[model samples]
Target: MPASAPLPKSARRPRPATDYDVVIIGAGSAGLSAALVLGRCLRRVLVCDGGAPRNEPSPAVWGFFTRDGVQPSELLRLGLEQLAAYPSVEVCSLRATEITASDQCFTIVADTEASRTRSITARKVLLATGVEDELPPLDGMREFWGHGVLHCPYCHGWEVRDRALAVYGRGKGVTGLALLVSRWSKNVVVCTDGPGGLTNKARQRLQKQGIAVREEPIERLEGTEKQGLQHVLFKNGDKLVREALFVHPHQHQHTNLAEQLGCRLNSKGAVWTDKKQQTSVPGLYAAGDTTAGMQQAILAAAEGSLAAIMINEKITKEECV
Candidate 1:
């Protein structure tokens, strides 16, 4: 057979499918951190986000060393702008719909504005897709959340210190949250909302600590729009006015992309990953609230950086081989 030259321009390798070195889903704290690291390493990266952050309802983000009280949106905007300096990193404001692996690379389909669908291929995938807090079905709870009714003491306890605080016994988190919030307020009330699994010993401990345990089922949250939460109304027509309220919301992973990719999940439904943030599925990794039980911005960012470094190293090694 005669030797044949390459085909015309239209019959090439299709430009290798525009495979990126890494594709990070969710541009929140974790995703942004990972992108920053990978960009600094001069890696080809793409970050797809829906712009709906987990803490969007929260007025301010706490516990970040120098950025305490920073608005979540402000922080994200600054982070996005900073990442803009890296020419290799691209940030697309889109929602990732599906991810599938093809040989050694992965393809990600995202839903952008105007309902347009876009796809990108990447050698590795980092899922920083955070979790969502399923709030209680109490009236006015959503309006006061992150203002006076809050979840994390580490995030909002200081502001309400020494005030009359109420904790809702919704799940296994009530006891722990009550104890922790006790440090912030001398007058703390734990509303069991009727019978719970708490033992007598636990009740005694709470009483000894000057924490009041109310067994009445809560009816609704009473508060004003401007002043935030004011009190809790009980089914018995009684009300206990409070300066602040604490409740651990039932949280669930916002996306099942990790599970769909065969990544192991923890007992809490969070994506299970190793120290390097690598999930069970090779080339697939997860970090931040997707894997962490204690969802904090700083911790998520740290995990993101760790995952980025691991990903960069893996890509470097593979390229060398």
Candidate 2:
């Protein structure tokens, strides 16, 4: 025999439609990580991303082992590249409009950048869609987000360590956040912006920690064009010459998908996930900042991996029967 010919397409077995085993919404670290594991397990996976990530404004993603200080965009790009190696995974740059569940499947409606609408169905849905930080309403505060204004001390503390850092936020939790920020800088001031309803014991605790409390209302954040944040001005004609500010902002889901799917949220407003990262609804899962208080890239990726393993196991068990 001289040579052997490959089988023709019609002669080969028919292929199934593009139905997916799992559909992942949000292609951030969590979503991409989940897709990677699912793809490696030989599961048909689809990842849909809206292009706007919570860390888009941040210059770097910190606290991630082996990839600390990496730019958020670059990290996600590398993750997608790794996922591309798996033949079972497909990534789409589209915004998910709505998701509806019926029986054991879900239909996702999404809109593309070209204004085209597409819908896909999957056996399971994983919402790696993260949370949106709602910054307090103070003039010029929006201008310094991810720069001079930050939320997590672990994320931005080292850079501003030993600098004049001001902790500005409302509610009782802010007192604790200020205390945590104090670890990074001895010169820390807590500006409640108003009567924070802090107990006398709480004030004593802060005082014991050498953190000064400013109860005046914040009028605006003053920043220079070159130096970023310069001071926090108060309505009472007082100002704190702070170099950086930390805040404990209220956060909510970036999209209504969780609420629409009736996923139970904890008291902290995060999606309630079990040890397996499975949501209240069977066949549905969640991970990342939307499901936890300790938001970090590495932790979110770990959660995504956990969810993927559980999802694959569920699918495998179902197929075995």
Q: Poorest 10 consecutive residues of model 1 by lDDT?
A: 9-18
Task: Give the worst 10-residue stretch by lDDT in candidate 2.
Answer: 9-18
Clash pairs of candidate 2?
Answer: none
| Model 1 score (lDDT) | 0.87
In order, candidate lDDTs are: 0.87, 0.89
Return the lDDT, model 2, position 71.
96
Q: What is the C-alpha RMSD of each candidate to the true structure, in Å?
A: 5.4, 8.2
User: Scored by Cα lDDT, where does model 2 land?
Assistant: 0.89
Off by more than 4 A, model 2: 1-18
Q: TM-score for all predictions? A: 0.93, 0.92
Report residue 285 deviation for candidate 2 (angstroms). Answer: 0.3
Candidate 1 lDDT for residue 11: 61
RMSD of 1: 5.4
Residue-level lDDT of model 2, residues 125-168, one tens digit each, is 99999999999889877889988899889888998999999998
